[model samples]
Target: MTSSPSQRLAWPDVAKGISILGVVLLHITLTVPESKDTWLAAFNVWLDPLRLPLFFLVSGFFAQKVFRFSFAELFTRRLWYFLVPYVVWMLVEQQTKRVEYHWVFGDPVFDFSQMTASLLVGHSMAWFLHSLILFNLFLWCVRKLPGWAALALSFSPILFIAWQAQFTSIAKAIMFLPVFVAAACFRDAISAFASAIEAPFKGEWDYRSFWAYSGMVGAYAIGFFIRRTWDSYAGAVEVTWLLPGTEALVRDDVHILVRMVEQFFEVPVGIAVAVAVSYIPVLSTGLRFIGSHTLPIYLGHPIGLTVLYGYPMALNPREVSLAGQWPLENTWFWLSMCFVYCAIASLVLWALGKVPVVGWTLKPPPIGASRRTTEPPSAGLSLSQKLTETRNATTRK
Candidate 1:
């Protein structure tokens, strides 16, 4: 059932909040070898299964309209939403890469032709947005197909794994297409399931305890175990499926069993995370706020990350493994810095988006969009408006 206008579907935002925050933190720590052994790293690793899966899942949930939208409608509402940032940020980041490449690799090397080609082929640092474009386009193309046929066709990309190897470039579109399609197609069922989980927590103390502890903690513990032993599990189960052909065909690194296990865990892990977020009223609201502004953080954080190269990130070479060292190697402080960085990027861009010319860097001009097209279903709410509503809800509460 659709939520009432007065009520919000809180979990999507919270899940997105968790995913985006983890993504930024993961990017920040990408160069640090010691970080891999930290508890914060484990926390990030535990979230690995939830990270992209949940992002693509909730994105497809929100994009259920694409299944029915006309091509024009798709372009205005969805395509524009992703393409703007994908193109604009990739362009911006390319500039950063020019300087960064010189610093890291001992001389600058970037081809403009390659940049344009990569953009056309959906390759960029903003890969999430790129994959979304491809996924949405696929949906639009398949919109006319019969239900079962469309559903069946969506699985075609999962077959691409047969061609991917640990050394080769991955097709992210194929890697994540099924998750996106599943969420878009099965959003109602998933939302209903999530709500059913949260319902217990909203009731009596006994029910709440059951959900808050037994339910969420149990899921987290399982996820923690799965993540901690992920390497061993993947290494242990290495069955390669070559296409129905000769030895020249591409190889699959880990078997289908690994993917099956990971995806099986994703559903419960995501639901548990959402339920936990909703039960914490104060924290949930804060996460929802962060989630709402994900576009800003998603676009701007990469630039912030690239800009911080020489400062927080220091390179230390070892014979066996090249490692990155942080000046102040405190895990808690590093974790705290990640949050502050995301928060600052979101806020600064949020404010700059109101500035005429400068705003283009963050939010693109909604091309081919009418005024109504520009006004999304939510039409967006300001922070002050949300605060006002909270204050006014006191009597109702």
Candidate 2:
């Protein structure tokens, strides 16, 4: 079947696929029992740049497609699909040793009251989903304003900096929404840009291929930098002299400035890289598959981490560690195992989602939904019919 205009715009799918995989890597690197080791820390440090922002960018892009929905619809969609899963998973994590554990083993002491609090505040990996829900809500409320107004409101951190002389702490998580919205608003301009860049070169030197490769690497680099610097910034800020007395009162403003800079510069860079990767043929195919299966992968991997591998590893980390050590002298061995394990878990979940009765819950928009609305004229139609159609087309086209 011929692809529609929407199908041709498969770059987002590619980006999402690659994005989730990288996200998986981030999670694995963080959760690998020996993540505290210097080498692994360094690896995680480098992966910082694109992690959160990439997801935000994709969220903005997809959300834009449905921005016409009523407030209730938006909330329902996000609540049922994203928020519910987040809360459920948070509870699951609380009951298990996933977030808390024995002090000697890096586990925190567990209390039911504290665990309940953690649900509201979010804990461990759950925070990302919590933040995502908040970000979407904020955008949905402000989305009706003029583009510039919405953008300015969304970029309130920057404005807050000029107004209050300090950054806000919550600015970072939500700052990228504006960038995502901006990209969505200026999609035509951006596509023209990609086209222009592609026009000058031939073959591998062509604009599309080069930018795609460069963008992907650049996106990864941005993620790495964010991971590295944000961690350092956080650590430094936590104990900084800037937060005493009145400074404590003014801390939110200060954080706003920091987040504005981080998102304005870093988030767009990541989005650009993702967009570029989407255009590359092979990368696009792989990314689309991954992107298409994002929900399954996201929902299922935790089960693997929680039940299949996590407990087993916790019981005998040394043995699992040895199995994880097959690639001698390489730290990546641990990371690779985590990746493989998560993938397996995702695949299992994906399979379950395809069961005849239950498959309806998670399937994405069907491919048939992408078909064009206008139909071509029949070959057997009278010449007068064709002439009449041509006259109408001449008027409308």
Top candidate on TM-score is 1
Clash pairs for candidate 1: none
The model with the greatest lDDT is 1
lDDT of 1 by residue, 125-242 (tens): 6777778888899878887776567667876755555545431223455445667777777777677667667665666355544554465456556655664565555333434445
lDDT of 1 at 182: 70
lDDT of each: 0.66, 0.58
Candidate 1 lDDT trough over 10 residues, lowest sum: 316-325
- Name the lDDT value of residue 317 in candidate 1: 28
Write one digit per residue (lDDT tens) for candidate 2, span 1-397. 0124325456566667766776776677666655546465665444454555566666666566445546666655454466655676566556665332552277565677777776775554556667667667766777667777777677654433333422222444445656666665555654554453343332335556466546645754664465446546643243233423342334455554445455555554554555567557787778888887787777666666666556655555553343354553244565666677788888886886678745544443222323325346444468897888789889998
Q: On a 0 to 1 TM-score scale, where does candidate 2 land against the true structure?
A: 0.66
TM-score of every prediction relative to native: 0.76, 0.66
Where in model 1 is the C-alpha error above 4 Å?
146-148, 162-170, 204-230, 233-252, 255-257, 311-339, 372-397
